[model samples]
Target: MFEEWSDRRTLRVFDPPRPVWVDMAATGMAGGFTPANTVPLRVRTSGARLEQRMQGWQHAWLQVSDGRWVAVVSVRLSSANEQSHASIPLTVAAGAIRPAESVTKDEP
Candidate 1:
């Protein structure tokens, strides 16, 4: 069973058949007025994966190594699919993960 906490806007997480692990990250954005272009030209998606060791979500312990990985972004398909790509770098220290800094931004 599951429960919804509207006040927190978060769902309760329960144990699944297997352990939940996060290895990659992705994002998407879509807007604009395009009557043509047939498909993409208005939407975009980007994703990237990390290498080396980063684990232990219990306390969020991550031991990442310095490396670089390729990241790719693609627009959702309609009639014509458009894609853009890029490479991202990972700067990690060999130790427990540190709390990420918070950023303030307006909603899209």
Candidate 2:
């Protein structure tokens, strides 16, 4: 799925073990971002709301200026029944994503 945000673009990708409702090999990605257009990302969803998680694919961070934006995508394994599905969105706290800075010892 795709989200056309005013600033940045958001696209949800399901790296499922296998395919089902969505054709693993087929989706009209006309003028849109595809897996080939992917970039490295960090994800978390420990305390995310169901409502936010249910948006398939969307941008959960706007004012946030640190971590990779959250992408809420649905997931289902080929072995499991269709009823067994979930919305896994990358959850994160505000301003929590940043590179760790090392501290150097000086004359204290």
**Which residue segments of model 2 deviate by more than 4 Å?**
1-55, 62-79, 91-108
lDDT score of residue 87 within candidate 1: 27
Q: Each candidate's root-mean-square deviation in Å?
A: 15.6, 19.6
User: In candidate 1, what are the lDDT values of residues 1-108, reduced to their tens digit?
Assistant: 223333322222223211112132222122334354564434422322222222212211122233422211111122223244332222222232322223111110
The clash count of every prediction, one per candidate, is 0, 1
My TM-score estimates for the predictions, one after another, are 0.17, 0.19
Give the Å error, residue 21, model 1.
Answer: 12
lDDT of 2 by residue, 10-95 (tens): 43333331111222222221133436236333212222212211112222334335535532323222212233334333333322
Question: Global lDDT of each model?
Answer: 0.25, 0.28
Clash pairs of candidate 1?
none
Name the weakest run of 10 consecutive residues (lDDT summed) in model 1: 70-79
